[model samples]
Every structure is written in structure tokens, then in C-alpha cells.
Target: MTINQAIRILDPDTSAEALGEIEYYGGLRGKEKVLVACDEACRIAVEIMRQHLKE
Candidate 1:
């Protein structure tokens, strides 16, 4: 996919929202918080990629 298409697929705002919710509910701190956020973001990006690839 083109860069624009990838950006649209990734949807940073949505990813931010997901991470915000995780942080709010998870109540994690410091390095643990960073790790969870990164993991969640990666999972979301991978899922989006997988869906687009299927189409």
C-alpha cells in the first residue's frame, strides 16, 4: 500500500484513543506503562494490516 493508504489504515487518532483507555483502566506506571502502550499499539497496527491484506 502507498504511504497515504497506510496512514489512513493506521488511524493514529483511533490508536491514541485505545492507548488512552488502556492507560486509564490499567493504572500502570513508568516502564510498565510504556511497555503496555507499545504492545497495544503494535497489536492494533498488526490487526489493521492483517485486515487490509485480507481485502
Candidate 2:
């Protein structure tokens, strides 16, 4: 699925989790951690793609 769709799916899962550390973390925090996680993942993926292109 697309990133947006993946976010939609993850949003609930994050929210439904027991509040402890991540839930109240609060801008790319709390249940929104997925947003940042996705960003990092995308960045890594892009970097890997660029490396392959250089080779």
C-alpha cells in the first residue's frame, strides 16, 4: 500500500497501544511517532537507491 494508506493503518494501531512512553511523547511524538519513523525509513531507502545508482 501507499505511504498515506500505511499511515492510516498505523494511526489506529499507535493510538490503541497502552499509553506509557510513546503515546504522550507529543509533533512527530505520541502516536504520531509513525510519521517520523516513516520519514527516516524513506530517507534511508532513498540513500540506498542513490548508492545503487552510483555503482
Candidate 3:
């Protein structure tokens, strides 16, 4: 899937810091997964920011 597509799929699985290792230690090999995580994180962060701003 494209990065954007992965984002849609990934936006829900924000679990443990283990995901970080998948992104960092893996390096270039991990880029695709990292992008997936980042997209999800971005969507989540934006939702959180909006919630806080609304409050």
C-alpha cells in the first residue's frame, strides 16, 4: 500500500514502544513501517490536538 493507504490502516494500532524499535533499529529497512507509524501518529496527534483545542 501507499504511505497514505498505510496511514489509514495504521491509524488505530498505536500500542507499545516496541513499535519504536521497529522504526529505529531497523533503519532503512524499516522506512516503510516507520512511514506507516508516522501517518498513524499524525492522524492521532491531530485528533488529540483538536480535542484539546476544543476544550
Candidate 4:
């Protein structure tokens, strides 16, 4: 899948500016890209949960 598709799948709320800032992973294949996206998404989710728990 393309970066745009991956971002939509991983975080639909992501802004256009954020999308522009994201570095291209030219070396990664489809599977690697998906894995990386999932990993980053999970990390972001965990951070959000932690912030909520603190409040």
C-alpha cells in the first residue's frame, strides 16, 4: 500500500501538514511498511492511553 493509504488506515485523523512531515521509507517493502505503520500507531495509542490515565 502507498504511504497515503497507510496513514489513512493507521490514523485517519492525521493532518495534511503531518503527512508532509512524514519521511518517506523508500527502502521498505509492503510488509515492512505495514509493520512500521502498525508499530507507530500502537505506540501513539499507548501514549494517548497513558495521558488519559494521568488526567
Best-fitting candidate, measured by TM-score? 4
Candidate 2 residue-wise lDDT, 4-55, digit = tens: 4334434656534423333456534655765555565566656667999999
TM-score, per-candidate, Cα-based? 0.49, 0.46, 0.49, 0.51
Cα RMSD, each candidate: 7.6, 8.3, 7.0, 7.3
Report lDDT (Cα) of residue 22, candidate 1.
47
Q: What pairs collide in candidate 4?
A: none
Candidate models: Cα lDDT each: 0.57, 0.52, 0.62, 0.56
Ranking by lDDT: 3, 1, 4, 2
Global fold similarity of model 3 (TM-score):
0.49
Compose the digit string of candidate 3's lDDT tens values, residues 5-30: 43444445643354566667778877
Distance from true location, Cα of 17 in model 4, Å: 22
Residue pairs in steric clash, candidate 2? none
Task: Give candidate 3's error at residue 54 in angstroms.
Answer: 1.1
Q: How many clashes does each candidate structure show, in the order listed?
A: 0, 0, 0, 0
Superposed by TM-score, candidate 3 places the C-alpha of residue 23 at a distance from the truth, in angstroms, of 3.4
Question: Candidate 1's residue-wise lDDT over 1-55, tens digit each?
Answer: 3343334334775646544554676674644664655655567668878999999
Where model 4 places Cα greater than 4 Å from the true spot, the runs are 1-28
Q: What does candidate 1 score on TM?
A: 0.49
On the 0 to 100 scale, the lDDT of residue 48 in model 3 is: 67
